[model samples]
Target: MTDRRGVVAKRAEDLMPGVPYVRGWNRARQSASALADQLVLLGLDSDFPGLVADVNVVGDGLVQLGTVRPEAAELLATLIAAGLRAELHGTTAETPATARREAPAA
Candidate 1:
């Protein structure tokens, strides 16, 4: 479908997050909102729902993840593979949000 700008638009789900994965990401990068949706696909939702509560799209290739457990850090490699970079914020006993070391993705 073409937008008002006359640019052919692709479905959000059809766009992959990583560059090497598909050409969809290229078109996705042109729109901030669309790219953000693509990034969500790379999130640790299935196996680690509690691990991440929220995903905030910061930019074309950046996202801030709200994590409940330290294990959420294990997603770094997957995130990288998805052509995205992430910052993890975990809830701590001392505070609601704190930076913790990332653990390996098991």
Candidate 2:
């Protein structure tokens, strides 16, 4: 049987799924900061703390969406997807400072 620590570790691994490649708009370097803030507001900060980062794609693309850690890729992708869908439904982004004010106190 696995130990308690092992079980918890395994669960964390399972909960952290794989990330998808999110491209299209919002890839511009200038947009990276806003993207990261969106991720944080969407509750992705628990998984990726730093913020949305601007990464260079190997091929021709205006922008790229990926995680520094393989595990975080999935959550990041989900966040982006949700954001896109929201925009499609006429959603507007909340400002970084505004989001911070609304975040649950630690």
Candidate 3:
């Protein structure tokens, strides 16, 4: 499992190579919302209700799936079958410290 911090840090570094942070973040969030809607339309909400509740965007190109349930694999497989690139990042027990850490200033 890859460290969540490292994954977050890498994403932070690579965020919007030439774009403004706010603009980039807003774009990503919008895209994530659209993707989430698409997933719902694809019946993921019905197929894996619990897992679907945990899908969220933490950064550009970074959709975080916050679950350790076995169904997560099935959800990922479904996403991949739909031609979406989905992969497991490391899992960690979420805590206040981790949750409160802000992304590095751009």
Candidate 4:
């Protein structure tokens, strides 16, 4: 179990580039829990229903959307459609401040 968590942690870290955007999304209107709910709903409605089972809201509103999965791109697209400002892992350097500024008001 510990080893699995460590692997998951590493995967989360690899997915960290999207954190700032998710945090900013939370700050703009929704809460981390709300975002998690959205993720679950989206997962359930999508082809990869189990792709997002372990969504966690970590320190300072960072949303960890579990480890990598085969539907990563689709998940990112779903999140963006749901108003999350995200990019493919390394494609974004957007900070929380920037995303907050860009986020639409709730």
TM-score quality measure for candidate 4? 0.28
lDDT of 4 at 18: 47
Candidate 2 — which pairs collide? Answer: 18-74, 19-73, 19-74, 36-52
As for TM-score, the candidate ahead, 1 or 3, is 3
lDDT order, best first, reads: 2, 3, 4, 1
Local distance difference test, per candidate?
0.35, 0.45, 0.43, 0.42
Clashing pairs for model 1 are none
Q: Ranking by TM-score, best first? A: 3, 2, 4, 1
Candidate 3 local distance difference test against the native: 0.43
Q: Per-residue lDDT tens digits of candidate 2, residues 15-90?
A: 2223221342235445766665656666555655544333222211133344356646644454456558779989
Give the alpha carbon lDDT tens digit for every residue of 1-106 in model 1: 2349954433233434543322333333344344344435544344343322121122122222334355554444444433332323332222112212233544
Give the Å shift of residue 75 in candidate 2: 1.7
Q: Which residue pairs of candidate 3 clash? A: none
- Which 10 consecutive positions of candidate 1 have the poorest summed lDDT? 51-60
Residue 9's lDDT in candidate 4: 27
Worst 10 residues of 4 by lDDT: 53-62
Shift of residue 78 alpha carbon in model 1, Å:
4.1
What is the Å distance of residue 100 in model 1 from its true position? 21
